[model samples]
Target: MNYRIEWKQILKNKEKVQCSSDWISAESAIQLGEELERNGKVTDLYFYDEMGVSWNMKEMRKLLLEIEEEPHDITLYFDGGFQKETYQAGLGAVIFYHQGKKKYRIRANNLFNEMETNNEAEYAALYFALGILEELGVEYKTCEIKGDSQVVLKQLEGEWPCYEEVLNRWLDRIEEKINKMGIRPRYTVISRKDNKEADKLATQALEGKEIYAKTIIL
Candidate 1:
């Protein structure tokens, strides 16, 4: 979890205004808070997470204690291919995650004929990946989402406006799902050439060759 550190520094028998720092890792925030307490009196020491949930030091420490010793690191790559003649869209996703001492990668794909355009198909492919994350029980963490579709990535990131009604609906649904999971999503737009892995999987989907695999990295 990431937290913004906020506290009041005592100065000359007066409490200065509360100061806040940019979000930092929870572990680092805790250590800094402890060090501040040891050096001198600090008042109103607390933290606010990315979702704006406030936490007292005691509560944060307790929660950190409950978390696994190893941290969660997850990345998702998605691509979509649409055939105008067939009106079929192929969606593909590659997910990499780590837990304890093990790292794993999963590849999956789907073919659907419902989307009307390639942009819509791109959004659908990303949504499909969210479903996979749900199956993996991912929640309350930061996830890196990368894709080749500038429309999908920029719109989701609010860097570009989405004027299409269908795409707006898909955007709303994706936002709702990720918010419900307390997920902090970071979107990166990559060149098509840089997204060959997902591109290949999407082609395979279009060809009726489905893939779903998990491989542990040694």
Candidate 2:
């Protein structure tokens, strides 16, 4: 997670002024906050996360310790493929996260028989990934979401307007789930080549091969 340090600083002329630093990592914010406290000139020190939630030095330290045992530094990759011939859709999701000192990767895929379009499938794949995150107890954390579907990513980012009612419904469902899970998502569009892993998983699902695996990366 990232935070900005905000506090009141006492100037040499006995003037009190508010000061805030640029957004930085939680660890860095804590380190800097401690150093500022040692100077004895800084007061009301606090850190605010991207969600605009503020935390005091004591609260932040305790929260950091708790977060270390859960999932953090998360990156999710998702893709979906639809076959018009049979109205079948395959959804794939891959998640990478840090728990304590270890890094882990999870791969999962599913097949559905009633998808209307590939765009809908793409949205479903992202929703499926969110379910995985919830099962892993990920909450109140930033997640970097990557996918190759321009329509899905752009629409989610509000860069492109979604005119289809079906797609809008999917968008609503996805947003509702995200809010309920307290997930902060950063969406990125990547080339199909760069998303080969997720693409392959979707393809495997279409071939009737299912997979759900998690492994330690470091």
Candidate 3:
């Protein structure tokens, strides 16, 4: 989590000015707000999240602390494999998160039929991971969404033109869902080696194995 420090330079022996810090981690902002309040010179402290919602010093501090007690700074990795012979798609996702000083990982996989292309399966895997994030009550935060598929990455980043109607619709749906969730996604393209866990999960799912595990990293 990152935040910008802002002072309202009032010139009345105190800082007075509306500081619009952009892309700040809400948790960090709350801590800064608390420190400012302790100065006694701060007439008002406001913490603005990425969603533009304002939080008072006390509320912001409490929320930040509570979030600290909970889990934050989530990373999700997703991948999919489509078997051309059977038209079966295998999906996999790995979620890494932090709670207090602890780190956790959640692994999941699924198998589905009816997907026409590997690309569509790739999109499905990402969408599935987001659904899990929503269930965990982690939204409106800075998150990294990664995949090994260059096609998926380029298409999502808008670097490549998507002419297929099916892919275009999937892309639009993803954009809409992301906006509604207020997520700031940092998309990255990783090598297949780095994405092996997810790849293996998908393969396992395709072989009729159910994979679901969550573990804490010591």
Candidate 4:
């Protein structure tokens, strides 16, 4: 997670002024907060996360410890494939996260029937990934979501306007789940070549092969 440090600093002429640092990692914020305390001129030190939630020094320290034992630092990739002839849609999701000191990756896929278009399938794939995050007990954390579908990712980021009623419904559902989970999502678009893992998984699902696996990585 990333946060900005905000505090009140006392100037030489007995003036008090507010100061803040750029968004930085939690560890770096803590280190800088401690150093600011040692200077004895900084007061009301606090950390503000991307969601605009504020945390005091004590609270921030405790939160870091608590989060270390849970699933945090998440990155998810998703893709969808649709077969027009069969009206089947295949969804795939790949998740990477850390729990304590171990790093883990999860790969999951599902197949659905009667999907209208590949765009709708793409939206469904992302929604499927959110379910995996929920099952992993990931909440109130920032997740970097990556995908190759420009329509899906851009619409989610509010960069593109979605006109299809069906797609709008999917958008609402995805946003609802994200808000309930307190997930701060950072969306990124990548090339199809870069999304091969999720693409392959989606392809497999379309071929009647389902997959679900979790493994540790170095």
Backbone clash numbers for all candidates listed: 0, 0, 7, 0
How do the residues 176-208 of candidate 3 rate in per-residue lDDT, one tens digit apiece?
878877788889999999999999989998999
TM-score of 4: 0.95
User: Model 4: runs farther than 4 Å from truth?
Assistant: none
List the candidates ranked by TM-score, beginning with the highest.
2, 4, 1, 3
lDDT of 2 by residue, 1-218 (tens): 78999999999997999999999988999999999999999989999999999999999999889888999999999999999999998999999999998999999999988889999999989988899999998888999999999999999999999999989998999999899989999999999999999999999999999999999994
Best-fitting candidate, scored by TM-score: 2
TM-score of each: 0.82, 0.95, 0.82, 0.95
Off by over 4 Å in 3: 9-28, 36-44, 69-71
RMSD of each: 2.8, 1.3, 3.0, 1.3
Q: What is the lDDT of residue 170 in candidate 1?
A: 94
lDDT per model vs. reference: 0.86, 0.94, 0.81, 0.95
- Residue by residue across 1-218, what tens digits does model 1's lDDT show? 57888988888877577777787877788898888778676788888887788889899888676544433578999999998889899999999887656788999999988679999889889999999998888888789999988879888989899889999999999999999887899899898988889889989999999999989988
Worst-scoring 10-residue span by lDDT in model 1: 63-72
